[model samples]
Target: MTRLERKCPICGKPRAAEHTPFCSKRCRDRDLLQWLEDGYALPGPPSFPDNPQDD
Candidate 1:
C-alpha cells in the first residue's frame, strides 16, 4: 500500500483521511495528550538555572 494509506501510528488500525496518521479523534487526542504530558523525551544534558558559569 501507499505511504498515505498506512495504518494508524497510535492503534495500528486503518488511518482515516480526517486524522491522517491516526484512526480517529480519540487517537489524535491521545497523541496530543502524550506531548502535553511530556511522554516523549529527547536526550540532552541536564540543565540547571543555578549554574554560575554564566557571565
Candidate 2:
C-alpha cells in the first residue's frame, strides 16, 4: 500500500507525484510567486494605528 498525503500547500488538494506538496505545477508556481512578491507575510510589529478613526 502506498501512503498518500491528501493536502496540497498551494491549492489544498490531494498531493500529486508531479508536485509533491502541491496539487499541480501551476499551483506550486503560484505559491512561489507569492513568496517572491512578498504576498505571503507574517505578523510583525503593528504598523497601523490601534483605532481606525485615527487614520
Candidate 3:
C-alpha cells in the first residue's frame, strides 16, 4: 500500500513528523504569527459594541 504524502501549508514542502502539518519550526512559527497578527480569520457576523456610547 502507498501512503499519501502531506505537504506544509506554509511552504509546500513535505511535512515533518515533529511539525506535523508544517515543514519546520520556522513555518510553524510563521503560521502562529499569522494568527496572532490576524492574517487569517474565521467567517462570522460583524460584532457589535456592547456600549453604544463607545461608538
| TM-scores, all models, native as reference | 0.72, 0.59, 0.77
lDDT of 3 at 33: 100
- As a TM-score, model 2 comes out at 0.59
Name the top TM-score candidate: 3
Worst 10 residues of 1 by lDDT: 46-55
Clashes per model (N, Cα, C within 3 A): 0, 0, 0
Query: For candidate 3, lDDT tens digit of each residue in 1-55?
Result: 1223878899998888888779999999999999999999889865776787976
**Candidate 3 structure lDDT:** 0.86
RMSD of each: 2.7, 5.7, 3.5
Q: What is the per-residue lDDT of model 1 for residues 1-55, given as tens digits with 9 covering 90 to 100?
A: 8986699989999999988889999999999999999998778865655666773
Cα deviation in Å at residue 38, candidate 2? 0.6
Better of 1 and 3 by lDDT: 1
lDDT of 2 at 42: 86
lDDT value, residue 13 of candidate 2: 78
Off by over 4 Å in 2: 1-3, 42-55
